[model samples]
Target chain A: MRRRRKGSVVTEILTWVVVVIAILWVLFPFYWTVITSFKKPADVFRLSSIPWLQFTPTLSNWQTEFTQRGPEILRGITNSIIIAVFASLIAVALGTLAGYGLARYKYVKWRNQSMAFWFLSQRFLPPAATVIPFFLLMKSLGLLDTRVALILVNTTFAMPFAVLIMKDMFRELPVELEEAALVDGCSRWEAFLRIALPLAAPALVATVIICFSFAWNEFLFALVLTYKKATPMTIIIAGTEHTQGVQFWYVSTRLLLAILPPTLLALTVQRYIVRGLTMGAVKG
Target chain B: MRRRLREKGNAFVIPAIFWVLTFTIFPLVYSFRVSLSKVLYGKLVGFAGASNYLRMFGDYRFWGTLRFTLVLVLISVCATTAIGLGLAIVFNRKMKGLRAFRSILTMPLFTAPVALGYLGVMMFYEENGPINVLLKYLGMGKVPWLSHPLWATLAICLVDIWQWTPFAFIILLAGLQSISDEIYEAAVIDTSSGWAVFRHITLPLLSPVLGTVIMLRMVDAFKAFDIPFSLTSGGPGTATRTLTFYIYTQGLRNFDLGYASAMAYFLLAITMIIGLLFFRRYRELYE
Candidate 1:
């Protein structure tokens, strides 16, 4: 019994050790970015890992980014917010309706299963395959480098997640409520809008968050489709490279700015993150 | 009333269907047309026949980058999944601070890949980055992380693994938690060895989740762009240029629109094949 007890204790210690290592591995890059964003240009080149020990942290980089680069940074942030919000709103609105339809109604021609699968398959169509075409398409419509163009493209990509997740959500919801509402002289639209939609609120929130994050973090489409006015935070962060071979201090500040929104959003909806990311596959 | 309601129900899906057809299917068809025609300055000048597709046969860069991308996908997917599974197993047991640990662990999943890549630029800096500094303290030589081809590839892979392992961990952990405790209790009665219980009971149960995770990771990894774009710029003489990166350069940078469109279709075909194969094998998971 003593021997078994000792073995269990050793295993517990080992597990904690692994946990600590995993935490450091996950966090160290973030720590490095945060500290580097605070470091002066000279201090940034230093091999110092600890803040206030190896180098003095400063607000100078943030100051410069805000003052001299203020307009550019603000433009990127505003564009990112506007594009992500509008795109996600459209995606969710459309996806919820489609998802509810697929869940509740049976289509003879397409079939619900095939329709759901088609939407899911759209999620797998790589940005690479579509980017060139999107660029050309946007250009021809005179919408290249416009927020509207990005909103449209982002909606296309984000809709798949909304459809798939909401489909699953509605399917899991009991049909009895809607059936009862229909029997009570309620119109089908009324039954859905008043009954099913309200009950699927949690799933709606999850889908919105996921869609928003996907649009916010989107890169390739933004890279290909937008140039100046519609440039999102991602492109701005990447654009740092072209300006005199990548000023790390400036880039670090921008990097933090770019990630802050999505990070906070993800944490707030932490419970739904696995399901969101997996398109409701794991049901976390 | 029933027929009218059914028509309205179908109408719910129309808006979404219209959006997809306009934005996705239309672009794909347009891209296919562009691929077949010769282009000058983004305008289709003439029919190129099969020239663009045939050009790939002789393009060493296309073949080389495709090979490199496959290697990256294989390594990144395997490593991320393995480490994630290991961590999931370790954290499967109840403990103090597990929630906090999990929250911190999943932080990378939400961060932008481009930001992470730029962070990687500093983290893997050859001279004075934290990693090299640590190596120096450990009495080891500094790795030319971004300068050398091999090291650059390794750096990109490490960054990918760092960003994605949490994704695998969370999903697999959920998978682990879903297995009822009574099964493990039953197995424990048969064998006191934890390894025996895990190998026999946990492994089989977790296989379905594992399969899903692997398929998702493979598809995502196959389209990797942001990291290589920011980190290496496909540098060290295009040593780490992925197929997607290569296609980007061909179409956007070089204005080889015809060839880029062709290559994009090629990539699309491969991606669809992989998706279809996984769907065929794992149809039940989706249903």
Candidate 2:
């Protein structure tokens, strides 16, 4: 181990202390939401002392949610899931093929640059700029409050990231492996589907998970496109706007269920997120 | 054979192309057309051309929201990046319980924005709120959290910081892992102090990731709505109304589709320029 000066040691300690506090500040709300969710509406605010856990937690609020808003929330969840699944599938599938083409095939002059620019534009655009337009178009198409609209937007939003990442992954795979396969009886499609897709599975998995999170957590577009029929999980959370003013416990229970998808998704894919982000950076 | 391969490649790309065209390209074009037209009872009417843009420029609420949005983005980006970088450096240490710390740290990033919005409203409510409660605990009196304009800014900032710093942490932590052990080893052998190592090595190495994070966070901050929209509804009298809220209010609530589309176009222009700059400069990092 290396030696450090006294001042450096103090700086390090202070840094950690600040970070620990910030982390607590960051996480406390989510913890609070979950804690408040499982409690009876009346007991929700009363159990401030046991903020971390509830010993005699009642299922009344959860039951209320199940009885009244359960189907509504489920519909939203199903919409979110279907949209996310389709979006992720389309995005990753197209992205992999696009990536392979860019990585392996030579294009005419300015073709690469144009394609590169197009990909970059898609990747870098903030959803805010594009969402307003989507609302109007969806209304015109009579696609408002539908999973199709959500799926379309989600895939477009995710495609750039998918392409960028998958390309990097494909580029790094040894050309010799593909060449070796070509030397055998394999055509390009066979080489890609069999050789490249299998090799890129980890990256593909990472891309799908990341895309799902974005789609699942999206709010602004969902609010615009869907009213109540096809509301997403994010919209459901946003639906608690009046609950804050109207009924505190009802709001709390609603808030709890709203965040379940993201919480479950993030925790499950926690390991993959860290690795996918890192590897894609260096490889790209 | 090349033609066949090209056909196959286009076939593979069909799904993505169709999706983008329908959702993104079509929406953008429709927004442009809608911005130029007047809305008549849920139907688009005759084209108004630059008249809508002119009206948007004249609208005080639009400018007010746009100004607040600019300030919000600038301040939040600076605040979050400075603090997030410091925390990332600390977490990079060989600390005890780092894994648990990491998982704990990311919980904020995982929380629903809508839920977190209410948490802010609750925290800063004038009476019986934790913020006030904590103030009393610290021997300080309660501060007006939502009543004052500055206080409203503070409320939004606190929520923004609370929600997004975890994202910064995750991105930066991932960046930190990519730095080779040998580089630090070499710096240590050179008798470089921690400051020197950080200033000379880590800063430059992490700039790419930092740039990406800043761009993303700024774009996000500019588009901030759900928290402020849900929490304050752009109040204490339009204090927290962001450009996005303005667009939604105009387009949806007031049903003034023309003005809203114009405002949305302004937003699009600003973000487009910023995004272009971000990618152009930082993209070299990948190369």
Candidate 3:
């Protein structure tokens, strides 16, 4: 009894140690960003390593972010929201129908399997490879630095993801409900619109969040495809380093602002993220 | 009803398929054609007929970047998977405050890589950064986390690991949770040691998820550009330039579209090969 108790006590200490270290490793950078954001510009560059509340906190960084750089940051936010929203909406709409088709109906002449693999394969194509073509195409169309260019590219980018998630979601739902709806004098379109769409609402939410999150985070295309007009938060953050060195105060403030909305949105849908990310490969 | 449904389904799918074809499929063909032609001053001057491919194959910088890319991918993928799996195992049990910890743990994954790069600069700053301060307090010399060549590569990989490890954790945790509790109970009844329980049962059951996670991280890390672009700008020198960054310089900066296209296509081939191999394995495991 004495040995068992001793072993259990030792294991308990080990578990707590690991948990604390893991949490600190994951969170300290974010914590530091917040504190550094509140630091005065001079204090931000000081050699005094203020660990937390040891130094005087200033609101100058927030002041600059809101006042001087306000329009640029707000423009970035607006561009990101518009692109992400349109991209997710279009991707979801097209992907839902195609995903439903792929999940439910059989195809002819190497149709279903080929189409599915083709869509999946594009997800593997790196963004860098497609940038040149996109740049030239957008330039020729006089669409460079336009939100429309990003919206269109982001739609295709999000489509494969949406399709994969929706396909899995549709596949898991039993066909009986839809079949019953079909038997009750409903057309296939009506059955799908009224029955399958409502049944897949949870996955739809997951898909929407995933699509929006990805479109928001996308950088390379946004970088290559736009210049001054459609500069997203990502580009603005990347360009924050000035003729001097990095102003940690300014950068941290912008970084915090840039990440907050997506983080909050993601947290609300945390459960679905695991499933949506793995593309239903592992059940959450 | 069945005939009409099939027709409607075809109609439903055609538009989506067409959109993908226009954006993805057509660009691929166009890129291939551009790869075979020489571009001077942003204009395709003439068809070079494999000269660009030949030049890329002979370029030492391309080879160096290729080597760096492989090393980066190996280190980042291995580190992320190992650390993530460790955290997943630790968090697998019921514990107080686990939910909040898990949520906070995922914060890095959601943050933009650009933001993370700026944050990395502060975290590793030489004079007053938290990491260096801790090092000094511990009686150690400050390491140049981003200035030196080796350390720059290491810094980039560390940042990648920091951002992506949470992703691996979520996937692995889901995998762990899917295992039936009866398996562990049976092993306990057999008086299995902790290591034996993990080695004999947990390892095999987790292999598929582990493989998938590594493959996903490898493919993603193989194409890493943003962190290095924002953090080190591919270096104090070219110490941290991966294949993607190299391609960006050649294509955008130099305007050598033909050569850059060749390199891009080569990268596409390599990534596609890895992607297809793992995809085949993934299909086998699931289908």
For this target, which candidate reaches the highest DockQ against the unseen true structure?
Answer: 1
lDDT of 3 by residue, B1-287 (tens): 22234544687678788998899878878888889998989899898998999997789999988988998999999999999999898777766777788887787777788778878888888877888888998998988988988888888899999999999998898898888888887877686477787888889999988887887788789888888888788887887888988988998788788888889999999889978887787764223
Docking quality category of candidate 2 according to DockQ thresholds? acceptable
Q: Write the per-residue lDDT of candidate 1 for residues A147-210, one digit (tens) a residue.
A: 9999999999988888878888888898889888989999888988999999999879867877
Error of 3 at B221 (Å): 0.4
lDDT of 3 at B53: 94
| TM-score of predicted chain A against the true chain A, for each candidate | 0.94, 0.85, 0.91
lDDT of 3 by residue, A32-141 (tens): 88888888777776644455556787887899789998999999999999999999999999999988888888777546767777777776788778888887888889
Where does model 2 exceed 4 Å of error?
A1-19, A40-47, A51-56, A243-246, A271-284, B1-10, B95-97, B180-193, B283-287
In model 2 chain A, which range of ten residues has the least summed lDDT?
A275-284
Ranking by TM-score: 1, 3, 2
Top candidate when judged by TM-score against the true structure: 1
- Compare candidates 1 and 2 on lDDT and give the better one: 1
Query: Candidate 2 residues B1-287, lDDT tens each?
Result: 22223334544444555655666676778788888898876578798978998997688888888889888888888888887787777777666677677777776666667667776776676765657777888998878888889988888888888788777777887787778878888888885577888889889999888887888788778778878877777889998899888888878877888778888888888788777887687565344
Q: What shift in Å separates residue A32 of candidate 3 from its native position after superposition?
A: 1.0
Reference-based lDDT, each prediction: 0.86, 0.73, 0.82
Model 2 global lDDT (CA atoms, 0 to 1): 0.73
